[model samples]
Target: MKELHKTSFWESLMIQKRVIGALLMREIITRYGRNNIGFLWLFVEPLLMTLLMVLMWKFFRADQVSDLNIVAFAVTGYPMMMMWRNASGRAIGSISANISLLYHRNVRVLDTIFARMLLEIAGATIAQIVLMGVLIAIRWIEMPADVFYMLLAWLLMAVFAVGLGLVICAVSVKFEFFGKLWGTLSFVMMPISGTFFFVHSLPQQVQEYALKIPMVHGTEMFRAGYFGSSAVTYENPWYLILCNLVLLLFGLAMVSKFSKGVEPQ
Candidate 1:
C-alpha cells in the first residue's frame, strides 16, 4: 500500500511543479529586478542579434543565398540555437557561481539548476515571440505553414536545451575551463548550424552533415511551418525530438550523480 501510494504520478508532478515554480519566481526577481526594460530585453536582445546576423550575411553571402529570404532565415535559426546556447552556457557554471545560495539547506542543487533553466527559457521564449511578431508586422516573415509542428519543434528544443544545460552545469562545477571551452565551441557552431543560409540549399553531402546537428533540424522545421513549400526539408523532427529526450534523461542522471557532493566542497 505504501509503495502504491508512493507511485502516484500526479502527486509527484504537483510537487515538482510547485518546486520549479517557486524557483522560477525567485530566479526572475534575482536576475531582473526593477529595471524599466527588465524582461523586455530578453526579447529585444535576440531581435537585435538576429537583425545583425541577417545584415552581416546579406553583405557577405548575398550571392550564395538569393532564393529564400535571409531575414526569415536568421529569425528562425538564430533564436532556436540562441535559446539552447544561452541556457546551457549560463547553466554551466551556475552551481559554483551561486554557491552562496546553495549553502542554504532549503536550496537544493536541482532547484538552482532548474531556476537557471527557467530563466533562460523565459528569456528565449520572449525573444522568439517578439521577433516573430515584428517580422510578421513588416511582412518580412510569414506565419507558420504548420503551426502545430512548429510549436512541437519549439517544445522539443526547449527540453533539449535544459538537458544540455544540466550536463554543462554539472561538468563546470568540477572543471573551470569547461566554461571557456563552450565559448569557443559556440563561436564555431554559428555558421555550421544553418543560422544564415538554408541547409537544403547545400550540396547533398553537405546537407547530410548539417542534418546531423539537431539545431539545423529544429530551425528548418520551424521555417517550414513559416514558409510552407518554400521552406527547407527538416525531414526529421521525430529524430530531433528523440535526441532531446535521450539527452534530457542522460543529463538528469549525470546531474543527480555529480550533484551529491557539490555543496561547498
Candidate 2:
C-alpha cells in the first residue's frame, strides 16, 4: 500500500507539472504570437518600462529623492510593481479566458492561474536580473550588499503576488464587477506599494500605516538587502508571511468552491 501510494503521488505530481507546462506554452503562444520578437518580448516589455522610468527619474527627480540612485531605485522598484500588477491582472480573467481548457478532464482552474502567475514571475525575474546586471556593469548602481536577502524578499513578494492573484481569480469569476473593480483598486494600491518611495522617508504616522501593507514590507526588505544599513526598512517578515498564508488558504478554498460550479462552455 505504501509503495502504491508513493507511485500515485509521483504520478499526480508529474501530471500537474505537464499540465502547467502545456498551459505556459499555450499562454506564450497566444499572448506573444510566433512573429518577430516572440518570447523575447517577455523580458523586453518590462525592460523598456524600467528603462523609461529610470530615465524619467534620472532627468526629472534626481535631486528630489536625496541619497538614492534613481536608476537603481527604478530598476528594483518598478519591476517588483510590475510583477504584482501583471500577475494579479492576468489572473483576474484567467478562468474566463481559458474556460475552454477547463473542459478537459485534467485541466483545473488552479492550473490556469498558476501558469499565468509563473509566467509573470519568471518574466519579471529575468528582466530584473538582466537590467541589474547591465546597470552594475555601467556603474549606474553598485552590487547589492546581500544577494540572498534581496532574493528572499523578492520571493516573498512573489508569494504574496500569487496569493493575491489566486484570490482575485476566484472573486473575479464569481462576481462580474470584481474584474473592473480590481483594475481601479490596483491603481490605488500603487502609491502605497513602496515602489517609488521608501517607508522611512515618510512621516512616522504614515510609516506606521504603510507597514500595515504586506507589499510595503516586502519592498522594504528588498531595499534593505540592496542598500544595507543605509536603507531604512520598517518590515516584519513574519507578519507578511502570516498574511500571505492566510490569503493563500482563503484563495484556495474559494477556487475549490467555485471550480465545482464551473460548467463547460
Candidate 3:
C-alpha cells in the first residue's frame, strides 16, 4: 500500500509558492531563453505595442484634438487591457507545454496556468510602469491623479485576469478548438474592452451597455483615477468585485474537474 503525506495549510501554501516560483523561472527560460533581449521581451513586446499605438494616435488621429492627454489615455487603456487579454490567452495551452512537469507531484495543473498568467501580467505591468515613467520624465503625460486609486484598479484587474484565465484554461482542456481560436478572439475583444474611448464620451444608452462588460469597469476606474476631476467615469468597484468572485469560483471548479482527466505524459 502507498503511504499518504499530510501538510498543514500554511505548509501546503509555502510548498505551492516554491513550486510556482520554479515553474515561473522555467517558463521565462524556455519561452524567452537567455539570449539577447530574452526575458526582457516579456515586457518589450507589450511596451512596443503600446508605444506604437500611442504614436499612431498621437500622429494621425482623424478626429479633432481634445485637451485630454492622448499618451496617458493610450498608456492607461492599452496596458491594462493587455494584462487581461494576454493573461487568459496565454493560459490556453499552458498545460500541454508543461505536461511533463506534472509527473512531479509537487507541481499542479493550476500552478502551470498560474505561472503563465503571472508572467503575462508581470510583463504588462512592468511595461506600463516603465512607459509611464519615461513619458512623465519627458513631460508627455502628467503624474497619475490618484496613485492609490489607480493601483487599486490595477490590482482588481489582475484578479479579474487570473479568474478569467483559469476559466479559459479549463475550458480549453475540454475544447481543443477553443485553444486555437482564442488568440484571434482576444484581439477582437480589445476595442470593446474600453481601451480606446471613454465610457463618458459614449452615448448614455451605449455607455450603460458597455458597463455591463467587467473589463470596462476596470478601465473606467483606472481612467477616472488618472484623469480625476477632468474625467467623468461610471465605475462600480463592488460590482466588479462581485464579478471577480463569481468567475474565480466557477473557474477554480472547472479547472479542478477538467484536470482530473489529464495524465502525466
Top candidate, metric lDDT: 3
TM of each candidate vs. truth: 0.86, 0.97, 0.94
Q: Write down the worst ten-residue block by lDDT for model 1.
A: 57-66
**What's the candidate order when arranged by decreasing lDDT?**
3, 2, 1
Q: Best by TM-score, which number?
A: 2
How far out, in Å, is residue 144 in model 2?
Answer: 0.4
| Candidate 1 structure quality by residue, lDDT tens digits, 79-198 | 888888888888876676566766665667777787887788777788778777877898866676788877877888888888888888777766778878987887688787666667
Among all windows of 10 consecutive residues in model 2, the one with the lowest summed lDDT is: 63-72
Sorting all predicted structures by TM-score, with the top scorer first, yields 2, 3, 1
For every candidate, C-alpha RMSD to the true structure in Å: 3.0, 1.1, 3.2
Q: Write the per-residue lDDT of candidate 3 for residues 63-130, one digit (tens) a residue.
A: 34667888788888999998999999999989999999999989988899999999999999999999
lDDT of 2 by residue, 191-240 (tens): 88989888888988788888898888888888888988877778889998
- Cα displacement (angstroms), candidate 2, residue 79, comes to 0.9
Two-way lDDT contest, 1 vs 2, winner: 2
Off by over 4 Å in 2: none
Q: Predict model 3's lDDT versus the native.
A: 0.91
> Candidate 1, residue 51: CA error in Å?
3.7
